[model samples]
Target: MSTLEIKDLYASVETKEGRKQILKGANLTVRSGETHAIMGPNGSGKSTLAYTLAGHPKYFVDSGEALLDGEDLLKMTADERAKAGLFLAMQYPVEVPGVSMTNFLRTAKTEIDGKAPAIRTWTKELQDAMTNLRMDKKFASRSVNEGFSGGEKKRAEVLQLELLKPKFAVMDETDSGLDVDALRIVSDGVNRAKENTGLGIMLITHYTRILKYIKPDIVHVFAGGQFVKTGGPELADELEENGYDEYLPEGSKESALA
Candidate 1:
C-alpha cells in the first residue's frame, strides 16, 4: 500500500501585516484505504494544511517534508503533485468560465495518465461517474463550476475525484453547504472512490456530521497550528459533545464557541 507522510511540517501565508505562520510542526501519516479526519475551530489552520499539501502558491513551506511513498511532495510543483497521485477538493471550488466540464475532465485525465484515453471508453466512464454522482447530463457541456449551485459545485469536485483516481485526496470541508440529500450523495461518491481505488483521505472539517457518512478511521483535533489530540471515531463523538473549548486557548475559546 502507498503511504503519504507529513513530517514536522511548518508553513505560513502572507497578509497585509506580514507573513503569518500557520502549520507549526504538524505531522501525520496516511496509508492507502485509510481516512483521517482533521477537526478544528475556525482560524486553527486546518485549511492552511490542506492548501499547503496541494502546493498552493499562497502558502509557503518553511520547513517540512511531505513524502508520498518516499518522494518529497514539497519539492514538486502543484501540477507535479497531482501527477504524483495527490488531489485537493477545495473548500470553495473556483469557477473556470470558458472551460467545458467534458473537455476539462478529459484533458486532466490525459495529463495525469500521460496518455489520452480512447474517446468512446472515456465518454462512457464520464457519463457513468456523473450519473452516480446524481449530476445532470447538461453539466457535461456547461462551463466548469460557473453559475452552478453550491451542491452542484461539490458534486463536480467529486466527479473529478472519481475520474482522476488520485492515490490520496485532501478534501477541505466538502460537507459544508450541502443539504442532507446532497450530503449523502457526495459522501457516497467519496466512499465509492475509496472502495474502488483504496484512496487515502485527509478529510478536514469542523463537524462530525460528515464523519457519520465518511467514517474516519482516525480523528485528530487541530489547534494552535498543530494536532493536539488524535484518537479513533469515539474522539469525534467527544468533540461533538464537548466542542473545541477544551482544545482552544483562553483567548480563542470565546470566539470558537461564538
Candidate 2:
C-alpha cells in the first residue's frame, strides 16, 4: 500500500507570459485501495494535474510538493518517478512509430522491476492481462498505438496499468473518445484493476456515465484551476442531470471555481 499527496500545488505551463498557471493551490490525497474521481469542464486543468504529478517536463510545478509513499516525487526525473511506481494514462496516447508493444512492455518492465523476468513467464502474464482487457493478440506485434482505434488505444493504456502494477495511477480522460461498448469495457478494466490489485486510482473525467461503472469513493468538482466541491458518487449523478448549470451563474462558467 502507498499514498500520493499533493499539497497546495501551484503549477503552470511555459508560455510567452512567462508561465500560465493551470493548477492553483490545488490539494489532493489518495491512498491504496481507493478510487477518487475528478470531474470538471474543459480547460479546468485536470490534465495538467496528471502531467505535473507524473513529472512531465512540459508542465512545471511552481509551488507545492507531490509525494509518492513519503518520497519526494518532485525531486525525481520522469523515468525515476515511473520506477517509483507512478503511472499516468494520457488522454491522448502517443504513437511510437517503431516501438513494438511486446518489446516496449518488456523494456518498461525491465526498467521498473530492475531485472528481466523469464520470457515465458512475463509473456504469459502479458497475454493474460491483454485477454482481460479484451484486446486482440495481434497487437503484441504491432507498433505501439499505431493507427489503432480509440478503444484499442485506451485498452492498451489499461494493459500497461495491469502489467506495471504501479502504486498509484492517474488516468486523464481515458474514456474520452470511447463509444458505449468501449466505455463499458474500459470501466470494467478499471474495476478489475482496483479489485484484483488493490491499486489506488485518480480518474479525471468530464462525463458521469463512467461513474456508474466504476463507483468512486469521492467525487471532486474542479473548475477554474481549483476544486470547488467534493462529494460522494451522488454528486456525479447530479452533475450529469443538471449539466453544471446550477453550479454556474448567468453567462458565466469562468467563475464556477473562482
Candidate 3:
C-alpha cells in the first residue's frame, strides 16, 4: 500500500546567518485511503513542511526522514519525487502564460506513466474530470492558470489531482482565499478525486471551513514549528472555539522562534 511516513522532521532554509530551522521534530504517518488535516498559524512551518516533503530545493531537511512507501524521498530530486508518486498543491499556484492545459497535462501524464494515454480515452477522461469539477470545457484549451481567478486556480489544482492520481499529496492551504461557493466546489472536487483514486491526502489549512465538508480521520495542531496537539474532528471545533493561544504559552512560542 502507498503510504507516507514523516519521522522527526527538522527542516531549515539556507541563509547567510545559518540554517533557520522551521519545522521542528514533526512526526506524522498517513496510510492509504485516509485524509489528514494540518492546521497552524502563519510562519508555523505548515507550508514549509509540505514544500520540503515534496523535495523543494529551497528548504533543507537538517535532520529527519520523509519516506514514501518506504522509498527515501529526501534523497530524490524534485522530478524524481514527482515520478515516485508524490504531489503538492501550493497555496499560490503559478500561471503559465503560453502552455495550454491540454499540452501540460499530456506531458505530465506521459512522464508520470511512462506511456502515452490513448488520445480518445485521455480526452474523455479529461473532459469527465472537468465536468465533475464544474469547469468549462473551454478551459482545456486555455493557457494554464493565466487568467484564472483564485477559485479557478484552486480548481485547476484539483483537476491535476484527479488526472495525475498520485499515491500521496500534500495540499498547502488549499482553503485560503476562497469564497463559500468556491470552497464547496473545490472540496467536492477533492472528495471526488479521493473516491476515484483512493489517494492519501494531507490537507494543510488554518481554518476549519474545508473540514466541514471533508471530515478528516485525524486533525493535527501545529504550533511553534512543530505539531503540538492531535485529535479527532472535535479538536478542530475546539481550536475554532479557542485559538492556539491556549495551546502554547506566549513566552515559550516567542522564545522558540529566537
Write model 2 residue lDDT over 101-170, tens digit each, in one string: 9999999999999999789999899999888888999999999999998889999999998888888889
Better of 1 and 3 by lDDT: 1
Could you tell me which residue pairs clash in candidate 2? Answer: none
lDDT of each: 0.96, 0.88, 0.90
Provide the RMSD of all predictions against the true structure, rounded to 1 decimal. Answer: 1.1, 2.5, 2.4
Candidate 3 residue-wise lDDT, 1-258, digit = tens: 788999999999888998799988999999878999998777788989999998888899889999998999999999889999998998999999899999999999999999989999999999998988899999999999999999899999999988998988899999888999889988998898788778899999888999998889999999877889999989988888887775566885687668
Clashes of each: 0, 0, 0
Given candidate 2, what's the lDDT at residue 144? 98
Q: Where's the lowest-lDDT run of ten residues in candidate 2?
A: 245-254
Off by over 4 Å in 1: 254-258
lDDT of 3 at 8: 95
TM for every model, in the order presented, reads 0.98, 0.94, 0.94
Q: Candidate 3 regions off by >4 Å?
A: 15-18, 252-258
lDDT of 1 by residue, 24-112 (tens): 99989999999999998888999999999999999999998999999999999999999999999999999999999999999999999
Candidate 3 clashing pairs?
Answer: none
Q: Which ten residues in a row have the lowest lDDT in candidate 1?
A: 249-258
